[model samples]
Target: MTLYGLVSSFYNQKAAVHAALRDNIDTRTALEELRVLVSQSNAYIAGRKNAKLAPNRMLLQSIALYLTDLLKTFGAIEGAEPIGFPVGTNGQNVDLESTVMPYLKVLSDFREGVRKIAREQKVTEVLSLCDMVRDETLPELGVRLEDHEGLPTVVKLVDRETLLKEKEEKKKMAKLAKMKIPPSEIFRSETDKYSTFDETGFPTHDADGKEISKGQTKKLRKLYEAQEKLYKEYLDSMQNGS
Candidate 1:
């Protein structure tokens, strides 16, 4: 079943947490927090922004989330409470290749480790370590992890919309590519002829019948040249990528 389905049926975190622990041996508050953080951060990282989110932030969050889930599934966390958690005596196999399933292993490992530790429970310290791991490892993994299909439907929809918009833009550009515009000087000459029309009774010229200044003409020519260069470069890039 989908996570949303399970979440709705369960009606609360407690029920969902219970089910997550159902197949496992043990659970921990730290582990739960870490998992929840991973889930939340993944959504945040997946969200659209005016500017892209930093690559490091996205990678680190995915890795941390993946690791936490993997440990839990592996039954590795030590010093874990038995009441709310499930122990894995059946030795259920974990699939690391499965996009979302691999994270359970991270949770399992953490649980087993906590169980072995002789020290008392330290939620803050453990969470701090999780945060540190996330921060330290994000940069290294950000370059490697590709965005996957398990994202929210909204994200997927946005991606499709963006692609369609690009197609429309390309079509518009192609249409414009065939059109020819009169030279600026020709356009200005026509405008100047009409500038002295009988209706206004005021001279449109600033000082004389000058159409436009040399500097303005030069600036416009530079702008047009830059745009042409940019369009040529874009076409070359498309060819190369193809």
Candidate 2:
């Protein structure tokens, strides 16, 4: 039966117990009614053995709530001993604690069983979903997961924004490195003019065999140093963010 049906059946049983108590039934009869209620609860649980996990969870929670109401009802009967037994003929004090203890234990155990199952199911689902994402989704997108202490697995992106920034900084550094050793400004021969390849794959040269002029070289060196400093700053920023 569905959770709702089970809950409805339990509710009807509870109503019968309530009516039995109100009618001043004999202690034995009242006890029997209570026993029937407990049995009904257990039967509901047994019947759900093959049910889906979600419905089972809902059923257990509903049972717990209903059991709370039943406990309150049991508490209200005057001069009734624990387990709903009446005071004895000899006027001996009823063992209220002992009588109630067994029923309370049963209810507590039922609630705890439900809690344990729910917690285990939740953890299993979370771990399974995480595994699927790590194993199936990440690799296809060139992403990786990094495990860390006291933290979730971090997704490592090949083309993340910070990495892209670092790439751009490296490109700037390369330009600066090339600038530090400036090319010759004047070419003396065809060999000098054909020394370096241009964007069009044609050879070009600044100066044939000579190095750059001192003044121009000094200016380029200053620019290269400044660029290098900026690149270092960028690198530090990236490291700090990571």
Candidate 3:
């Protein structure tokens, strides 16, 4: 079976065991089912000689270790002693408390060992596989995975702040491209162009190089007044923090 299929089967078995425990029903059937699944997973791993199957092997091993611990816990709850053996032996009297304490300690130690192995091997491989699958199926979702030293690979959220900044910059550039120049600047530019010469392309002044026509002088004055008025308004807007 596929790796995903195996993983899914493992979870289903685990949930069955939990349900049985929660309902105070017969857990023996659920436990047996879990054991069978674990064995099948291990058998599949054992047949694979490829290095690519290393993660799958680790996953199965972790599941087997966890199932073993779970079985031990159930045994401890139902047995006369935690070890599932009679209290007093053939030759010597076994202290009930002492026997139970050692069983508890062994159970605890085994559980801790399983946790360490799962963290180092099974969990990391699972996370890496999840990231790979996500990348293949949902690349447009902007989700990402990152690896860390001495830690599992983690899912990274989309960078909304950077995306927002890029969007805003595009909008600002578009607005600036179509923006109208202020009236004050337009007026000044027009005035400079007209002052260069008369409409006929001749110098405004004659041989005397004094004043030109009064009409021309009046037009120039009106142009200067209009420019000054707009310039003052622009300065006022700036001062007001517009």
Candidate whose lDDT is highest: 3
Assess the local accuracy of residue 238 in candidate 1 as a C-alpha lDDT between 0 and 100: 64
Residue pairs of candidate 3 with colliding backbone atoms: none
TM-score: which candidate is best? 3
User: Per-residue alpha-carbon lDDT of model 1 for 153-182, expressed as tens digits?
Assistant: 111111334455555686677645622222
Q: What is the lDDT of candidate 1?
A: 0.43
TM-score of 1: 0.25
With a 3 Å backbone cut-off (N, CA, C), the pairs that clash in candidate 2 are 186-207, 187-207, 187-208
Query: Model 3, residue 233: what's the lDDT?
Result: 63
lDDT of 2 at 138: 47
Candidate 2 off by > 4 Å:
1-4, 25-27, 56-59, 72-242
lDDT of 2 at 95: 52
TM-score winner between candidates 1 and 2? 2
TM-score of each: 0.25, 0.26, 0.28
The candidate with the higher TM-score, 1 or 3, is 3
Considering lDDT, where higher is better, how would the candidates rank from best to worst? 3, 2, 1
| Candidate 3, lDDT over the whole model | 0.54
State the C-alpha lDDT per candidate.
0.43, 0.52, 0.54
